[model samples]
Target: MIYLDANATTAASEEVRRAVLAAMQDGFGNPSSVHIRGTNARQTITNARDEVCLLIRGALPEGVTLTSGGTEANNIVLRGIPEAIIVTTSVEHPSVLRPAEAAAEHRVVPVLVDGRADPQAIAEALPASGDVIVSVQWANSETGVIQPVEDIVTTVRSRRPDVFVHIDAAQAIGRIPVHMDGIDALTFSGHKLHAPQGTGALVLGDPEETRLKAQILGGGQEGGRRSGTQNVPGAVGLGVAFRERAKAFDEATGALRAMRDAFEAAVLSAVPGMRVNGGSSPRVPNTSNILFPGIDAMALVALLDQRDIACSVGAACSSGRPEPSHVLLAMGLSEDDAYSSVRFSFSVMNTMDEALSAADIIAETVGKMR
Candidate 1:
């Protein structure tokens, strides 16, 4: 099958799988234990932390707190500081949007039709006084449109330097260039980068200065940020994934972009009136969210799956709900248009031949459906 659902999750690389196996066999002891086996497990986690920090470019290794996944990491930031006024965009993933909505005080900044949050709007959303945290997604999951993270940081800092900036980089980490120089807290997932599932991290700029508090309390693990017996194998697997991707970043970026562009060109040329959802925006190279004017996205997804090709309508977490995509709706798409959109996300594992074939199949299928 040709898997075009990288945004949902990526297949773990062979190296990562092997590393996980070795970790499970040789590093089975609890990270908190004091024995030799335990020291090895602790060192495994430490090495993963270093790799993760290196991948993000200038992230604090001491501030890296491994979590179950992006959802948990996001919750730690959104819910950790309840008293701080939460400022976030409407186009963020449900993980960020849901918790931010639950905050006692929050400001949901609107996005443009291109699916980008306005830096000025975000800056204006900040209060004149009191603590605040402005959270934004580095890249959108469905459309792959990249937010102006540096612009937001600069604008927010101009108004309030004390206002913390957090980024949910689940879709951006391995796929694009992400700098942690200005970001206060950045979260990324392992499964998104060909690592084992149930692995992720929250990298803080300054763990001491951030108002982030621990949501999960236990034996004071993760420096009291997230307390639990760490997943040693998963961390090792994630480290391998990060290190391998970092080495091949340039090649992977070009390959994924080429595949996505080729696929979109073929499909759009063949299918009259077909349009890319965020075509005009600055997006990550691996994603294409297309609008098939008058088709049911779920039905199309099923048809593609039947043909041994995989894609999706929206975020995996919100699939099967029979609702239009919130990301599309926030970008001013009508409910019908939102329901008619499908996301085709690529990975380095995909081939140009597969992209062309998928485009042909999609064009023919859409014609038959119409």
Candidate 2:
């Protein structure tokens, strides 16, 4: 199968797979225990923290709290901040948007016509008073629209020193250069970066500085921020995956971008009335969202699946929802336009040949529909 649904999840690398297996066999001891094997397991988790922290350059290793996955990591941050004016985008992943709904006052910064977050709009959305919390995705999972996180953070921080800025970097971590500098907190998922699932991290500036409340409380793990036994095997795999990606991020992104451009060019030439969503914005290298105005994306997705091409209409986390994508809707697309969009996210594993072949399949199917 030509797996283009990388924004959903990536297949674990062979090295990561081996690391997971090795840990599962000999690293089963609980990190909270003091026994020799447990001590070794604790060390393994610590090592993983160091490697994972490297992905978020300049982030304090001590402030990184491992969680079950991105959802829990997002929940930890969104729910932890209490009684604050939450400024986020209407296009955010459901993990961030749902929790923000219960905040003091949730303000949504609408995406621009090109489907990218407007730093100015986010800055304008900040309240004139009270504690403000800003959370924006580093790179959109669906359209791959790169948000001006540093600009947004600067706008909010310069407006007020106390405004907490959080970035959901699940789609940006390993594929792009992520710096934790101005960002108060950041989140990433293991499965999105060629690591095993059930592993994710929430990196904050400083545990003591944030005075972050514990969301899951019990054994006082993750420095009492998150309470549970660490998934040593998954952590080991995640660390290996991060280290592997760190060595060749730029080169891989270059190739992915070339491949994406070729595929997009071919598909656009072959199909009529096809619009490239987020084409005007700076996006990550390996993603493309195409709008087929008269086509049903969910139906097209199924047809593509029949031909062994895996993709999605929007966030995999919320695929079963009956309505159109909130991301496209926030970008000022009509409900029909939103439903007509399909997100084709790529990874290093996808090659130029595969992308071109997939493009042909897409064009043929879309042409038939047209």
Candidate 3:
């Protein structure tokens, strides 16, 4: 099968799998226990924490805490922050968007047609007078467009020194450069990299400066910020994944971009009216969302799946729902245009040869529809 849905989930690397297996077999003791095996499990989580912090570049090891995945990390930040106004973008993942909507007072800033959140809009959305949490995705999941995180954080700081900033970097970490210098909190998932699905982390800037009360009250774990028995196996896998991803990072990203760009060029050349969503924005190297106007996207997906070429219509969590994409609608696309869009995401493991072959298959399949 030619899998093109890396944005949904990536296959765990063999090394990560082995690490997880070893952790499950030998590091099974509860990290909270005071025994040799327990100490080893705690050490494993600490190593993973350090790896995650290193990946974010300037994030503190004291600030990184393991979570179930990006969704939990996002929830912990949004729900745990001091009661204040919540501000987020219209095109954020539902994890960020939904929690912001449930806030006592909140603002949803609109995005440009390229699906990038405007720093100016977010700055303007800042509450008149009070502590606030400004949350934005470091990069969009559906369109793969990078957000102006540094600009937004600067804007928020200018508004209020105490105002907090959170970035959901589920798709950005391990795939691109992510600096945690000004970010108050950031979220990333293991499955987006070459690790298993059950692992993720939330990297903090300064816990004392931006205090977070735990929402998950249980046996004190994760420095008492997050509580539960840590998933040692998943943590081990995540540590291995990040450590491995950092090696030859530039080469991996560049090659992925080359293949993605080539596939996009091929698709645009061979298919009529093929407009790429967020085509003008600075996107991550490995994702492309294409619009096959005047054709049903689900039909194209079905055709692609028949030949074992897997892609996606939009976010994995929102699959099986026939509604138009919220991200596209936020970017001013018509419902018809939004419904007709399909996303092709790649990973380092996907070969350029298969990419070109997939392009040929996509063009041939889409041509028949047209």
- Each model's TM-score? 0.97, 0.96, 0.97
Residue 68, candidate 2: Cα error in Å is 1.0
Tens digits of per-residue lDDT, candidate 3, 77-184, equal: 888765778999899899898888887888889998878877878988887887688889987888899998888888778877677888999999977899887888
Error of 1 at 310 (Å): 0.8
Q: Which pairs clash in the backbone of model 2? A: none
Instruction: Note each model's CA RMSD in angstroms.
Output: 1.4, 1.7, 1.5
RMSD of 1: 1.4
**TM-score winner between candidates 1 and 2:** 1
Sort the predicted structures by TM-score, highest score first: 1, 3, 2
Give the RMSD in angstroms, all C-alphas superposed, for model 2. Answer: 1.7
Cα lDDT tens digits, model 2, 230-288, are: 99999999999998888787888898899889989999998977988989899998889
Best by lDDT: 1
If both were scored by TM-score, which would come out higher, candidate 2 or candidate 3? 3
* TM-score, candidate number 3: 0.97
Q: What's the ranking of the predictions by lDDT, best on top?
A: 1, 3, 2
